[model samples]
Target: MSRNGQAFERYQKINDLFNRRKGEMAVVTTEEILQKFEISERQWRTDKQKLEELGAKFEYDGRLRGWRYIEPFNFSDNIPLTLEDMYNLRLAVATLAQLNHIADFKDLPQTVNKIRKAVGRWVDHEAQHKAIYFDPLPQYEGSRHLPFFLDAIEKEQQVQFDYFSFQAHQPQNYRFDPYFLRQHHQRWYVGGWSHDPNEGFIRTFPLERIEGEPIRTGKYIDFACKPKGFNPITYWQHVIGINRPARGLVEAVVLRFNRVQGKYFESQPFFQPYTILERTEDKLVVQMDLMIEIELIRKIASYGHEVLVLAPATLVEVMRSFFAKAAEQYTPR
Candidate 1:
């Protein structure tokens, strides 16, 4: 094989070894790589150098005697797409196609076309003949304001918008210091510091509830004047979904799932800090460290009898009460 072909083959082998133990701290050791590929120490060092040149970062642990990725890195970014890669890109482009109708993503169709043109040759026409389907995008209001809010957040400016919340009797004008724009469950929300005396703290507002265009104030956000210990990036990390509780602490919420649900949860976890405590033939017990919030409770309720809360007496009672009220709705009058 040519030098470039040999290097690509080595890159593929290295990626496979790292991925086999995904999420583990220690990946393959230098000795293991040399033995597996039947290469010398010099060749291994040269391979590492080539990978680093392509933006892959690695750190060596003396105690573990293995290398760990400093950051999540993938060889796919630097390598040419394989047949499988082209198929995956097609699926991704199909998903992005759904966003083309949205005003905020108006340029997506053009971008998608560009991608399709670039990979058109590699795509499998026979596979394209097979009917692959995707659910139509749901019509969501206030998406047009996404760019407006995004610009304000980038500029660190204050904004004012008339909001009509479900709990309110009338629309209220709110002055906010735009900090972050987040999307949850297909709805856009702007999270920032509110100027209202009743809500003089960091909060999130649904863009769908905004009545009109948001007016951006010329004044810039004074980060020094922000509430103590506020970080836009880490604000919602400890919680599932949105709406961080005003006075909530992170708790280890334990749950037991039925065999069927356990398989699903194991494959696709609901949130981060997901760890399996115990596993049996019939049930799987898992733990997630999160702040108890309405969204968390709602998520648990969505699973119905498939899941059971095992720890934190407070969450157990909340789930019980939530089910009771839900059951009451179905009772005969």
Candidate 2:
């Protein structure tokens, strides 16, 4: 094969190795390539740089003691997904459908299926695992908030809305400092400051809860005033959910996992760098920070009796009151 053909094949194998052991250790050495592909070390380095120019990036970290790869780094870097890559994606999609997924689509299913079948059969649990990571969230069916928010975002203006909160029986007018339109699960949320007289500061409001036309400010304020170098996820690292992300310092959130359902809580945490508080033989006490979006926490709790709100007394009480009222329906009604 020509030099370019040989380099491309080597890149494919490298990508496959990294993808297979995602989040695990992967090593690349001159010896391995020379033995496996009958190529020299000089040739490999040249090809590695070529791949980097093609938008592939990997970093050498002395702490992990190995190189870390960022995959599919470019969808437009002159590198098309290979036939094998397409097959893997297709296989994943099929397996996800089997997992009681009630996914809906408008028109691309038939064509996507045809393309997938033309690739190849995916192996065993590989497809299933890939599916779990690759699924897309459902889109909003009727989103009226976008136009209003878009106008305000573009104009750098403030907005006021008639808001109806879940616990509040009556609607209230709220002027806000809208910063972001965050989408969690399948719903859209606005995170900003509320101009309430008593507790006048920032808060979050779901788009669906807004009752009337939004009043926009004709003024401008710099968004750079907030922490300029921050990831919302990392910034709110201890947040129990995304409904309300802690503005600055993280708060500790302790949760109790229900007996039968606690295992689900053990699956993937909302954030890393968290400590597992206490694990009795029967139940698990999982504690993290309370900087996550509140809506995210509620959605996780909606999994029925799997998880319980333990601390912050306020959140626990909120859940307690909600479930108490819900339980009343079963009391010989």
Candidate 3:
């Protein structure tokens, strides 16, 4: 290992020691550290000094006979990164650069350039080689409003905008208390509490459907109206995709996929609450606890003949109807 690699390894070891002692009254003595690393006392002192320089503060406890952190710190934040770490970061920056075409990520290319310059000193010229490439994402509208919605959510403010739903002949004005922004299937959707007369519940609005920029209402969020203990992060825990049906209840959705398609589900699951009930040479049966929603239907239909809905009579009937309609489109007239 190089000098930088050795330094990173030693810092990682020290970090592990501190993490093990976290939330406990126990302390790790300098002798113990030195013995573990097989380093001299002088070298250990130097290491401690370097760590302190990197925002880690430690003091020797006379009564405890060991060193204790004076403040919360993460050694990795300031320590030299290994070559592999630098390479991986470079790859990530490259990947981020590909998203520059998106309005919300327009600054990514500049940020990637900044990172390349910062790491130029440690990395070789070969780092500039485009060794990996990502498929270009299709340009989708409505990403430009991401920053505005993010700001509104952060400030706990209400916003007003004009939205044109597919069913509506004209755009309709709406007042909403922005809660969170979610990206699904390359499109952006903002989930929030709607203040419209007919829709007074939490709902999501697709950004592309929004006619123009949303203006802040100059009013703070109505905390009283928000459901108690409702977390935006876990709001869709039982639902698939972004939409949560108005009266949908969580159900056990069982599916059987052919061996080939089963491998795909096994390697890359689509839902969080996923479990494999049975596996055979010809088929794979999996169950997911989720709400019956449009996204779930779309996902199941996407697998076509490769997958079969095995449980939840309602879902099975829904799938049958969906396939029947789809098959009718291809039927000879």
Model 2, 222: alpha-carbon shift in Å? 8.1
TM-score of each: 0.73, 0.50, 0.78
For residue 70, give model 1's deviation from the true position in Å: 34
Best-first order by lDDT:
3, 1, 2
Pick the winner on TM-score between candidates 1 and 3: 3
lDDT (tens digit, per residue) of candidate 3 on 211-322: 9778998765577877678798888889878889776588999999999999999898898768889999999999998999988999999999999999999999999999
- After best superposition, candidate 3 residue 329: deviation in angstroms? 1.5
- Over the stretch 129-196, how does candidate 2's per-residue lDDT look in tens digits? 65444456444532567667866866768788888878999989876767667765556677655656
Ranking by TM-score: 3, 1, 2
Choose 1 or 2, whichever is better by TM-score.
1
Q: Give Cα-based local distance difference scores for all models.
A: 0.85, 0.62, 0.85
Q: What C-alpha lDDT does candidate 3 achieve relative to the native structure?
A: 0.85
Worst 10 residues of 2 by lDDT: 98-107
Cα lDDT, model 1, residue 9: 88
